[model samples]
Target: MPEFKTEPYITDSHHHLSHQDFSSDIEEVIGRAREAGVEILIEGGGEVALPYYLKNCLSDPYLRNMYFCAGLHPHDAMNFSDSILDKLRSLATHKRFAGVGECGLDYHYDNSPRDVQKRVFRKHIELASELKKPLAIHARKSYRDVFGILEDEGVPEAGVLFHCFSGGDEDLARILEMDGYISIGGVLTFPNAVRTREVISSVPRERLLIETDAPYLAPQNVRGKRNEPSYIRYVADELANLWGLPVEDVYFITTYNARVFFNIDIDHGGDIVYKLGDRLYLNVTNRCTNRCSFCIRNFRDGLGGYYLKLRVEPTPDEVIKAIGIPGEYEEIVFCGYGEPLIRYDLVREVARYIKERGGRVRVNTNGIARLYHGVDAIEYVSNYVDVFSISLNATNGEEYNRICRPLYKGAYKEVLKSIERAKSLNKEVRVSFVESSGADLTGAEDMAEALGVSVR
Candidate 1:
């Protein structure tokens, strides 16, 4: 029932509007994609007319939402030469150029000799490395050889994306090992794509992106039909189902990933306040006490479509002004890309203001404020903070230290002490444990129970 409230924030990361299939109706296709909420369409697949078609798209109002990549396809590897590389270098300087290639080996068709394919693929790799751009690779039944060539060539410093990836878990592991991203397409919706469904879930959300690979692989609903960017919602739907999230959530996550992949800047000017569902979260600062192994900031700049990497830490007045009508949200939370308590005075001021405005307040913290402030920091903010959600990622100090990597010694003990102080004040409190951190969830729950607080 939860549908996208606006044009769905889908980014068709790999498409081929230059393909002859859309030559007659390209304008209509672009319009339909815009209507469907496809915010971006990264046109790729380096065919002969790709450069000229992309140039036209850049100037076309209907295709303004598109970005492009240029290179030689494996099928035309025989045509690869210095002149083509020179052409690619010139194209790479374009303002709208997002990446280098949709180039790699495709043994499935064998349109070009395997030796030539490998040779040209290496050239593209070297070119992408020299240009410092991400490479959009296409490998079909040649992932083993493709990965081998990449390992030998040294992946581009800008990054690499295995687009329309159909590899198994081992191939995925290799991609991840190389710190590469993989973009899934319509194949995910095929009833027979059990391997993909089972394997893709293991991909870290931050490292994952979605694409339509239009004019090629169409989702089950549009099977055997000419695919276009508008149908990307089907791929999003499948990702949503696999990730057990709302379709809109998949749209935001994948859209954010695509933007980060292509280095698209979203200038919202350092969001002091952001919304997720009905809760308004205050991004008071980008400073955290612990470098948690499972922290989202380690992977991406933003979360839930809001860029939390602040240009400057917001003043208390800035945060309060941003939360114009605090009571409109279910609750105003002091949880952002960083530790709220690190800015304890700011948290206290903003929380007090929200509480007076009939707005409920929650403060999520690593619970090490007492050590930093040399006082009962939890109790200091307890009057205004209605609920305290603290991180209890591990049961004991040793385990906590290993996972959180806090800057201070005895920091884990301080976290436990802070929780005790909150409970003593009779504040509503919950301690959280991250399952993916490989910590003992049962131990954390038992520790929280002994402290008379609920486990989140």
Candidate 2:
């Protein structure tokens, strides 16, 4: 097997940096990790390792990006005492301590009684809630019990994660429904781990993370060797293969997910312009005219690895600076969490800039831009935009009212007018409907046909 060293920077979201295996040569381990581009290392293990992890691993100048999580593992549930809880509570207040756990039921090992594991796990959940920190859960042969406990305890707003996840399809569905994250490790690369691979393929990219779980579960290629953070690229490579995306894309997304989940201090990019495949999308604002029931922002913070929530809307110059050169992409798209037409002047200016530079331009709007501005917005943008992909989300006005909940009255009619105006301007007009958002697809197609426009 080839050495996996492709990504410029990567993160091992779970590892045991203080474990005795690396005690003799821990500096060497970290040096190799840095050489392989592993910048962030999160150390988690049973509670006994917490003090050493904080004092040694985190304080090491060479390991500047180290963080730690403190909790009692289920294997040592019998040792869960008030003193340990007190220690964890104290450590939780420290800024470098990222979360609570590696704590959950371990029915497979049965090292501790099942009832004791449950009781201990509940206490950890309570501690996490009190600290307002995420839970780094470790479950084996106890997915149902873990799910039940989390549901009963009520997941904290900090969120929950199943580390080195090895659950099946039903388990994956339940995890997603709870908005929990799944961290994959070297086990994902094992050819015989069919169930783990299935879960990996089914996990939503936004909710996925990668880890080493090092000093254990080394990748099949390095099966018997001691695993370290440097080997995270192998797990990332396997995930890239499973997702059929570039290795860099896998690193970027999973790294982003881990940072958000663990609240790690890293530059999130907070980009105004981001590229997907051949298209570049501009996120000018988070303000939207419609409150769609199925909008992803209601469930999570951002979309497609970019945090679209703008603290302050970027100027047109800022957007252009982010875009660098527009001609490299197939098209410059005006689509994001909000209605791009709200900033009409900016859109027109940027569109003109891109068009002058030999780049195609498209605007994805709710088609109610005219209603928002009380003018024919399509006509205004038609001169600059090559494609007008309007959101004809519902078949009729009544359905539109129920689904889109537009701020303006008579928005559906205004949208239809906007589509007609675009067509009259000789712009390539396409009506788009979110099929999964309960839109009447057949009716939408017929409506598009009547308007002499394409439907997608």
Q: How many steric clashes between backbone atoms does each model show?
A: 0, 0
Best prediction by TM-score:
2
User: Looking at candidate 2, what is the lDDT of residue 319?
Assistant: 80
- Residues 311-401 of candidate 2 have per-residue lDDT tens digits of 6788888887777787888888998879999888889988989999999999999888766777666777677899999888888899888
* Candidate 2, pairs of clashing residues: none
Compute the lDDT of residue 420 as modeled in candidate 1. Answer: 82
Distance from true location, Cα of 11 in model 2, Å: 4.6
> What C-alpha RMSD separates each model from the true structure?
4.3, 4.9
TM-score, every prediction: 0.84, 0.84
Model 1 is weakest, by summed lDDT over 10 consecutive residues, at: 1-10
Q: Write one digit per residue (lDDT tens) for candidate 1, span 1-456.
A: 111122236789999888888888887888899888897889885763474466567785745557888888899999988888888888888778888888999999999999999999999999889988899999999999998999899999989999988899999999999989999999999999998889999898888998888899999999999999999999988898898887877887888788887776555455566666567888877888799988988877787555678878888887777788877879989999898998888888999999999999999999986666676778778899899999989988888899899988989888888888888888999999999997766666677889899998
Cα deviation at 31, candidate 1, in Å, is 3.7
